[model samples]
Target chain A: MTSEKKIRVLAAKPGLDGHDRGVKVICRALRDAGMEVIYTGLRQTPQQIVKTAVEEDVDVIALSILSGAHNELLPKVAGLLKEQQAEQISLLAGGIIPDSDIPYLKKKGIKEVFGPGTSMNTVIDYIKNYCAR
Target chain B: MDCLCRKISEEKERWVKTTLNKAKCDRRTDENGEDIKVLYTPDDICAIDYLSAIGFPGEYPYTRGVHASMYRGQPWTIRQYSGFATPEETNQRYKYLLKQGQTGLSVAFDLPTQIGYDSDDPMSEGEVGKVGVSVDSLEDMEIIFRDIPLDRMSTSMTINAPAAVLLAMYIAIAKKQGIPSTKLRGTIQNDILKEYTVRGTYIFPPRPSIRLITDIFAFCKDHVPQWNTINVAGYHMREAGCTAVQEIAFSFSNAIAYIEAGIKAGLAVDSFAPRISWIFNTGSRIFEEVAKYRAARRVWAELLKNRFGAKDQRSWMLRYHTQTSGVSLAAQQPENNIVRVAYQALAAVLSGPQSLAACSYDEALALPTEKSVRMSLRTQQIIAHETGVTDTVDPLAGSYYVEYLTNEMAVKINKEIAKIDEMGGAVDAIEKGYIQKEIEERAYIIQKEIDEKKRIVVGVNEYLVDEKVDQALFRVDKKVARQQAAKLKKLKKNRDGQKVQLALEAIRRAAEGNDNMMPLLIEAVNAYATLGEICNTMKCVFGEYRASGWSGR
Candidate 1:
């Protein structure tokens, strides 16, 4: 069931959060795992992230936010993707997110939430499994 | 001495040849990838003269420590970096911390404030008071320090890019409190070079950013003599995942650029060099971190005295503040981070810094609760009062491994600094994305090592834990954003609009021309103009900076 096409993903940092260490690391790891990663750089608003994802036609949007703005921002991005009819793209998140906030993020359409100490392998595998399914 | 050295070298060679196994000889790299030998004796640091190279504390080439008495004179200040939510809440927290025996104040402005955006700005959505206090005008600053006396408290604000505006607000508040500028003692993290590389709060481009920094240097020299105009920080760089040696080299290179910029701005080297402080990150690799600090002091002294020709004794000293690394903390076994923080803080103390902040154990997850922050401050207090390690100055000065590592670290750090110098300096290197690429490569490797289990992180990679722990994490109230916006609205309604317009115009004129900006900034803040107004006035002239993204190439 291995697909011939490489997975296209967009890594976005939303809401004025500039802790890019996690996002950049995930981007590099995604690229290394044979997926195309387009980093939106630091400080992209939710609208900008959705617009870029829809325009670039990415298969997935991975949002990273270390600043505690995820509660408001993650849902906004999900809502925007739904409004744009781009719900096919899987959404993921990682950063200094507390465990208590994970359920809310998942309910808001984030497929999975990765906290600190998550291995790159786990992320790559999740993407592969999701694509295969 | 030469004959004795030869005899010892021969004896060491003979011992290695007879006793060492192949496995021991095959491994030559230390944790940070530096080459290391099996043993170290007098032969390793034989070339470093004791007096000229590794001199006494408070002397030239201060390899041991900066002050003669060190902690014996006075313990390093317990300066925990804290601020969250509205100005009133942060003010309450400040009072609580001071009552809990915190000595100095280190303010952390929210991201919008750091980037010069008002709470109501579209760019500030969902971000006001998220990470730190949101200050839109002098009114917010007044609330942040409502009852705290400016003259008695030594404050350090972690603000860059818009550091000038924040300092002006601080001075304006002090004036309202009837305190003169001379009585103000504090530091502003005005180091913008790293912003282009790692921190990412930069506003203006490199040339104009350096211009603003130099303006502060000159302004502080004449007006606020006691204020530390800039804290040349490598802490953020290290947190973004550079090695200890790279941290020292890169930060020192940035310092060199600032010194050069100040001299070019028609100021004497010694006049502004003494007020340039530093911020560094200390990690859990105890010996290496300690050696890194020692080598950093020696190399900085040599650079200031010999290269920059700074004549003042104060100019030769490398006074720094150290913070325990937050990246080293793991969320799985949150309690383990306490031990990690303790070890890292011990390393910073052993190396002799002017101030220290131990990261709370719960910071790996979210904002630390009051209980965790109290534990963090208690960690520093324990090291200062309980641990006997601070009984003397530079206790591990003459150890063979520590000295060898310190000397070797200096050589490696100098080599890296030379590479950056050849690229024309920190600004040029950052412009070319050279520094960013180097840091990414190191950071990637570090993460890869942890992933592949080459490096073992307790309770993360090695030990398996299957437990759900419910802990109360401090969450900034979402109401903070609305409240801050309302405050800004009320202030805009009450303030003298014409006077604000006039002050902002003056700022714009000064920013466009070759003029010192501090006096004009103070005037603008006193007129009750918002931070966004002042920064936007300059932004029209300086323009915003968009970094050429590093795609990990």
Candidate 2:
């Protein structure tokens, strides 16, 4: 597993939502899965998240939002990544996002959207498999 | 007495070996990780002297209940925390709730408003009216409370960092309605310590944030005598996954800091202690929760009387509001949340809360629809009237198990409070990242337990389902942001700029010194100064708080 570089993932909360329980749990799970995880603390803007992901050269940016602002904030992060020519970094999200909003979020460049009750093992495997591909 | 104790112990031992072993009974524990014996008898609570330790209701060390009559004289207030979209939309919801027989109001402000931002600010983009109602200025406040007389209504605003500004707006609105400040009654979730640790809506650092709270305490003592100054909250921390024990201990530690800050600021303990109230989360563990509340009341009563040497009896009471735990709800089968909330609400009612807010069944996914919220309120009503649980004061007081559990919980809660006190106080512990780390660890453990299927959350880990969610969810209007931003722009342009500027300047001056901030805040709020403008003025003096060290790494 050390032969290849450790999978670097950037976990960010990109709005005024302070619901960090899901994000914190996932961060720990990813780290235990032998992946490097960087958690940008609460109340981060989309631009800041994109900048950190790009500067850190992380392979993925996992966004967690529960305040119902995913429709506006998630797309903006995806857009900012494209604007910065950092579209290589895969984008995924998990929170209270509805199933109906998944298609639109995917179209906006979020590859996957995990809602409430998704296990941490599922999230870690998704990242490992996504990075492998 | 000795012979009876020995006989009970022998009988319990015989039962454990014969009946318990035959049934293959496993060792059990409560949420606080305390071991529980299968059978409890007179020997378990024989050490407790009934007159002193388990006193009568409304007496000193209020372990049984706070009121002597309990729910017989007056039932608990049914207040549901709700709001979303524009002020007009939220006003309709409030009026609807009142018409539906809700006893009190609990306001849920939007994120931007909670964190002291105008709707038009860049930081507020996409978040204007999402989680709660958007209030940018006095105009928005008036519109929200329009035609609802403030003097008669008991409102609770869930605002922390910007609690001073919001309370001032409520006061100004009351004054406009020809009601005196003394006649107003309500509570502001003016707790900032929990904001730094659990709920992240803090604007300033701890020192100045607590200073603002003490200022409110002092001001309300003279002007708004009926107002509860601060609702020191453990509900959020509990929602973040702390045990019921940590919830009581941590909130009391935070409360001690506030009371000390008030006394340091030259206010007598009795003057502000009577106005101090609390909010705790009542979860699915019915027996443990009931015992937790009972233990909490006793600890708080003793803390006020023995530790602080308070002379007033009202100051010794631990009057609290209970909200059924939202974290316990499962999003898999949203309908299952109704039964969960009903059980939690039953636990809270049995524990004797001053008020209660039952989480709606559909809350795990999105904001609750009208139908879902009404069902939640009706859950409380059924417990009050039909269930007959509230028929007697402290109905479960004499049960051997509850009495024993209450005694055990009080010892553990006091031990935890002592640990926090050893770290100087809650403020110091929070600054050192001690409290945050503790809660994060517990949260991770709880999550892992559920993931491993050890914790059986119905419809989540144990009961699997493949049906899609089909409930009619309430959706916040996306256009509410644009409308609020435009309204804020117009209000800024139309108000007297000179008066607003003068009021903000006075706040700046008061914030820099030891002056009470409520009057200046009320003046600024009355002059149409935005919440952000007032908070920003103080921010220039107090600066903003940036959390460090604790990254959940």
- Output the lDDT of residue B481, model 2: 90
| DockQ of each candidate, alpha-carbon based | 0.62, 0.59
CA lDDT of B148 in candidate 1? 96
Best of the candidates, DockQ: 1
Q: Each candidate's TM vs. the true structure?
A: 0.98, 0.98
- lDDT over C-alpha atoms for residue B23 of model 1: 40
Error of 2 at B17 (Å): 3.6
User: What would the per-residue lDDT of candidate 2 be over residues B1-553, giving only the tens digit for each residue?
Assistant: 5788889988988887878888866888877566888778999988887888779999988998889998998999999999999999999999999999999999999999999999989999889889999999999999999999999999999999999999999999999999999999999999999999989999999899999999999899999999999999999999987898999999999999999999999999999999998899999989999999999999999999999999999999999999999888878989899999999999999999999999999888899999999999999999987999989999999899999999988999999999999999999999888988888888889889889998888888887988998877788888999999889889988999999999999999999998899999999999999998998999999999975412232
